[model samples]
Target: MSNFAESRADLESYISARVPLISIRSIEQDRALRLVREMAANPRRGNLPLWIYTRATGTRDLRTNAPTSDDRSWPGAMDFAATQFANRPQSTVVFVDPDDLSDDNSASRHVAELARLADANAGSIILITDNPLWSGLQRLGMSITLSLPDASEMYDVIHAFLTDHRGVVPIEWNEQDARRAAEFLVGVPEGTAINVLATIVTKGSVQRDDVEHLARFKDKHFGDLAGLERVEVAPDSQQVGGMTSLRAWLDRKHQLMKSDLRGTKLRPPRGVLLVGVPGCGKSLSAKAIAGQWRLPLYRLDLAAMLGQYVGQSEGRLREALDAADRIAPCVLWIDEIEKGLAGQNDSTGVGRRLVGQFLYWLQESRSRVFVVATSNDVRSLPPELLRKGRFDELFFVDLPDSDDRQEIIQLYYQRYVQREPTAELLDKLVGLSDGFAGSDIESALHDVGAELHLNAGAELRPEFVVEAFANTMPLSRTNPEQIDEIRTWGRERAVPAGRPPTSTMSGPQHAGRRVVVLSD
Candidate 1:
């Protein structure tokens, strides 16, 4: 059942069973109030009388907004409620977010006393709060938590809004469009969904394109980002050198990400693990995935999650993971994941605990959070994380080979020089850039482009590009042993990111077994 329906049923049962103290935890106060009001009106619960007490409106009848009491204060309402529970049977009193409930304050103590009086008379006292009630007060009754609406609930809310405003506004959205828009609006509150639709209705027309803007609309509500850093991808930043295998894999997964898997057993595609050389396109591929899939990119900075106190790091990690789940259908990039989770011998057990917590969320969470985790030091990663099913697949991205380097050269050549490189110049540059990472090639071309731009009216020369390449040193050349170690580790375990070189391509092919990527 949806969270809303399940919570409603729980509330009804509590009221029917004469539960004296009932605590509801929810951020949507209005929705919770409406739920209580609706349950009270039902005949199964004998149409019980519900008295709602809000700070703004002291005490009022749930059926009508008319005040049931003259005094408009919390103490006065409590006094009136105590009197009713003492005399009347099956009375339901709801308090809307009264202050001083965090601990055993006077207000909580009074509520606890009132709850015992209600218990004797078989009446129910309901407390609607955004925060958790004190353990002493909460123990007096059962608590039900109402989460944000699911996809099905979102669809109803969106479709209802559109139906209500059909003639008022020009709407070009069909049923499918509404359903698609509802999927995007899944993690938002019901009122926020309506507000977003209203904002769109304010515009002249609600075209089919407006459905795609719903995610950006919901993004505005979560501006703080908690522990995540929003990584913006520009149009030009989407290009990657050459990971034909990874690109093709992501292309297939992108469709699954956008598809509606409501009635099926299939889950959306989990993310991939990119463990390869530094400066090679591991991190860049994260951005490229976000750009290609048209989903917002968020970087989970592990450094920000650490804390000096006990259990602080684990708490922070949970908050970050929960935040990611709330912002679903987005790419979560954890760059150099090993640095954060590779502690095997630390004196404190925080590192091991963090690893366990992360693995639990990754394996069990059904949210559409595509995790693109890259690591330069794979040896330090926990063995359990490397086991099957932790990630969909672990991909090894090595330095660009001759064919990959040629593609990288052409990509940067057009971007910086504003023209394609000649075939002869490309071959020579490709050979010269042997063993260079993708970033190294880009750096060399960027320098050449900057110099050319500074010297206005100067002609673009191949010699200038060659000279720029000559002056640079790549990491692979500086640390050959480290590169070899990474390559040897990946050679047997992970799938190669680049496609197999053909006979026509003139370069030494890296040795690895090619695994075929299958479609569901």
Candidate 2:
């Protein structure tokens, strides 16, 4: 059944059962009111008279679309509702912004009294508001949530807007583009989506680029709501020197990840967890995946979600995850995931609850939000996160192997030097920088560039790069125990990101390198 149809049926059943007080929580107040009006006029509902109340409009008979009396205040409205119930016992009264009653003790009592009267008289009082803030009414009524429109509803919204604008402005969209646009608009309200579509087509015509424009629109509107920062990934940033296994897996699932597989039994690819040494391109892999897939990227800051008030943290988390689902077919990059989830054993139990909520969403959410979580300290992570079904795969991104180092060196050289490195230089640097992470390689190359800049007319040479490598200390040498521990854990639990090291280069080059203690 359609979502609206199902909701209508459920609401009808509640009314038929004489549910006295029904609280509807929704941002779409207009839509909810319209549905309520329709239900009031339905023959199955006994054509009950519909009364509506708002702070601005006071109390009005919806059937007549006219103001009933001067009792616009909360207490006055309660008295008016009572009078109506006494006269017509089978009526429905809807209060808009009833959350206002939460702040007024007298109004709250009046609401409670009205609820009791409605129960005895077979009338109904519906409270409609964006937030479910009527705590006092909780035991007296049942709450129904009206979610933002889904993809299909969004598509219909687009179609209706296009039909409305027919011949007024040029419209260019195929079924595929329309579907994609709907996906891009998923987490937005129907009203906002219509306004966005209208604004896009206002210039001249709606092009395929409108899909990306919709993404930006969502980022601007919804990104800040849930402690998520929309990361703007450049198209040229897809290059990564290694992670052959992860790259291959992503390539295989790229199409399925973006496609709408609602009817099919196959679930979309969840994501990957990259646990390894820091500066080993774990975070880089996330950016590369989003760029490669041509999807939007968002960084979730779990630390920012902590709230001082009870349930606030969980509320923020729920909002963030819901936003992620709304902006689906995108990559959610959670860097240093262990830091976010490390407090699972804290005394307050907030950490445990947060972890539980995140895991539940990760497992149950069918949205196309592919999560790419990178962690430097795997030991700090809970075992529940490492379970098989949590992510598509767990990858171990150790220090680059020889071939990976060679490619990384060449890539950096070409990028920084504006020219490819000679094969001899590449081979020597690959051997000399053994156990160096990708960041270490880039640092060495950057130092070489700095040297060349200092000597304005000097020719760039391979020996200059070798000198820089020798002078720098890689993390492996400085934190051998930690690296060894991480590698040991990865060996048994995760797939290697690159092929096994095959170089036999003996490394006295790293000898006498300063041991800089680093913290993860």
Would you estimate the TM-scores of all the predictions? 0.93, 0.84
lDDT of 2: 0.82
- For model 1, how does the per-residue alpha-carbon lDDT over 1-520 read when each residue is reduced to its tens digit? 7898999999988988989999889999988987787787797756576788999989998777789878989999999899999888888899999877879889889999999999999999988998988899988989999988988888889888888988898899988888778777878889988888888999977998898787677677788777898988889889998889989988898888878788999888888999988888998899998888777899998867889999999999999999888888789999989888987876798889999999999999888899999999999998988998989989999888898999999999999888999999998899899989999999999998899899979998888888999888998888999999999998779999988545754668677898999999
User: Number of clashes in model 1?
Assistant: 0
**Whole-model Cα lDDT of every candidate shown, in order:** 0.88, 0.82
Clashing pairs in 2: none
- Give the alpha carbon lDDT tens digit for every residue of 382-495 in model 2: 889999999988999888888789888888887777688877877889889898999999898887877777888889867778888888799899989989998999988898
Report how far off residue 102 is in candidate 1 (Å). Answer: 2.5
Strongest candidate by TM-score = 1
Model 1 vs. true fold: TM: 0.93
Clashing pairs in 1: none
- TM value for model 2: 0.84
